[model samples]
Target: MSTIDTSKPHSARMYDYFLGGKDNYPVDVAAAEQVTSLFPAVSQMARTNRAFMHRASRLLAERGVRQFLDIGTGIPTEPNLHQIVQATAPDARVVYADNDPIVLRHAEALLHSAPEGKTAYVQADVREPGRILAVARETLDFTQPIALSLVALLHLVGDEDEPVRIVRELVESLAPGSYLTLSHATGDFDPETWERVVEVYRKGGTAAQVRSREEFSGFFTGLELVDPGVVLAARWHPDLGARQGGEEIPLYVGVGHKS
Candidate 1:
């Protein structure tokens, strides 16, 4: 297990704080406060992004996707990926991967699967796709369709990490008919505010790079995008329960089928 570092603010912990979760440290709170001060709608943005994940997972389950692999799984909040999918399809199998030790400590909350389903957790980083897939295979059958969820995650992966290539690698590993569900923070709406937000994260020892719509769309290069593709997180399949509020949250989301 990796040691829990409370010394510096972690993106995951800061996100937890944004979501009103108690799993974060004072450092995380201080950094998140700075971000909130910069963009007061940040907490709403976080909640909107989270809602997209829930709706996407349930929609995929309804479409007969029986397996899921969620990378950068943050602190467990209610209605987690597994819970939402299993509620839609009781036999759904979910594998969660996160590098955060605080998330590892709360992994138990993510394991309460339905009797007909299964769930597993991998304490690995998104940069280590091989390790995540290896552990996920223990619970998910890669031969069939699976939902690869990267909700609110890729933005934390700086350009140095080659995030697009990482997404390509993960998607290529999946079987045809699988889906990639992603939501990312974007600076297209209010660039100046987001720039300051990025600075705050970097100062707290976290690397963050909010992308533009074109850059965000590149992640789904060869996949067939679902309807209303690559729109604001609130606008994607709004009927599925995502709030279609008038305020634009600086987040882009989409679902694509690997056919």
Candidate 2:
């Protein structure tokens, strides 16, 4: 089992706390509550992000893409990426990656793949794109179309981390028709609230770099964006689905084809 340090607040566990799940520690709940005070929509944002992920996965399955590489995968939630894809295409294969030890410890939930499909977890960081790709290749074919999802993950990556470079490496490794699905927190909606939330994360020992629409869109350079390009999470293909708990929050979601 992966060791979980309950002293610090982890993004995944904090996220789980925000969603009213029991897997989070007191520290995570504290941090999540503090952030919630600043931006009450944070929990809604979490649900929205999950909904977008479901829609994206369904679109990929409908498009005949059977392999998925989800980086920065958080604690396994119900109807996870594998569940959504496998519900439509039973033979789908998925590789979940996250640096969080807590996620690795609870990864058993993610391992329950459909009998005809494959679900595996890799204990790795998003910055280590090559390593993730290498291990994921065992389950996913590099020559075929695979959907790469980084939903609500990039904001945690600070400026010094060179997120753009990491994305470049991952994008270059994928074949044409492979898609990149992303949803990130932005300061555009409410700058003051975003700033307060960023401070909360900084105090928690994690970096949060909330980008604008242009900066978020910049991550998709060299790729072809799908229709209704890079819109708000609530607006992104809203007709496709809805959240189970509550209304969707303000987030930007987009899907881009490698070629």
Candidate 3:
């Protein structure tokens, strides 16, 4: 088992805290509370991002895509990607990846797949696309359509990390008809207030790089976007119930096909 450090506040744990889950440490709660004081919609954004994931996974599974690779998968909240897809297609396959040991500790909960479907978890970082792809393929078929999920991830990947290039490498490994469901943190809404929240995270040793709409859309460079392309998180296909409980969230969401 990977060691869990409770002294430093990790983003995954902070996110779990935002969602009212009990898996976070006191440090995480303190950092999350700081962000909440600056931006009360923090929790709303987290919930909305997760709802969008459910909608995106269900949509792809309904479209007959049975493989999924979800990276930066935070602490397992219910109705995880596999659960959503397997609910529609009993034999779907999902590979969940995360760099956080906190999440690795909870990986088994994320692995409870349908009797016919299969689920696997890899403890890895998003920056190393090759390692993730290599390990994930053990449970997923790279020759088939796979939805690469980067939900509420990427912003933590600062400029030095070459976030766009990392995404390109991962997408390049996919076969045609593969999908990319992504949601990123944005400063488009209440920039000043959002800056305060970002500052709080930075103080906690997490570097956050909120993106602009164009920058967010740039991640889908060579793909075809689905309907209502790249809009506010709450605006992305709400018919699947991605509504934000009546609050405006700054995250931008989109799903693209590698055709």
Top lDDT model: 1
TM-score of 2: 0.96
lDDT ranking, best first: 1, 2, 3
lDDT of 3 at 250: 81
TM, every model: 0.98, 0.96, 0.97
Worst 10 residues of 1 by lDDT: 241-250
| Native-referenced Cα lDDT, model 3 | 0.89
Q: Which whole-number lDDT from 0 to 100 does residue 153 have in model 2?
A: 93
lDDT of 1 by residue, 1-259 (tens): 7899989999999999889989888999999999999999888888898888888898999999999999999999998999999998999999999999989999999999999999999999999998988898899889999899998999999999999989998999999999999999899978999999999988987779999999999999999999999898878888888563444788999999999
Give Cα distance to truth, residue 119, candidate 3, Å: 0.4
Candidate 2, clashing residue pairs? Answer: none
Instruction: Give the TM-score (vs. native) of candidate 1.
Output: 0.98
The clash numbers for all candidates, in the given order, read 0, 0, 0
- Superposed Cα deviation of residue 29, candidate 1 (Å): 0.4
